[model samples]
Target: MLGAKRETVSRIISQFKKAGIIVHENGNLVVLKMDDLKEKAQ
Candidate 1:
């Protein structure tokens, strides 16, 4: 568990979606740009 609130997680996921870093398909999350995602994580 990341220990983050659900709202916090949801917001971050929404940001990622907006940035085209990830997507939700068939109830699964797919990473579109691993390098970009890693950069964002930093």
Candidate 2:
């Protein structure tokens, strides 16, 4: 997705999880801090 390699995407997601930005449950990714992440994205 977004032209990123599979492993690279996985690592980024892992960082998000560790940073309290997201959580994985029941195979779903839940964003814990959308505004924070959104601002970071920009």
- What are the per-residue Cα lDDT tens digits for candidate 2 across 1-42? 335466876687788789977767623533334335556666
After best superposition, candidate 2 residue 41: deviation in angstroms? 12
Clash statistics: count for each candidate = 0, 0
Give per-residue lDDT, candidate 1, residue 24.
70
Per-model TM-score versus the true fold:
0.52, 0.52
As for candidate 1, its clashing pairs are: none
Whole-model lDDT for model 1 versus the true structure?
0.58
lDDT of 1 by residue, 16-39 (tens): 788977757622543334435556
- Candidate 2: Cα lDDT at 24: 73
Cα displacement (angstroms), candidate 1, residue 17, comes to 0.2
Model 2 CA deviation exceeding 4 Å by range: 30-42
Evaluate residue 8 in candidate 2 and report its C-alpha lDDT on the 0 to 100 scale. Answer: 70
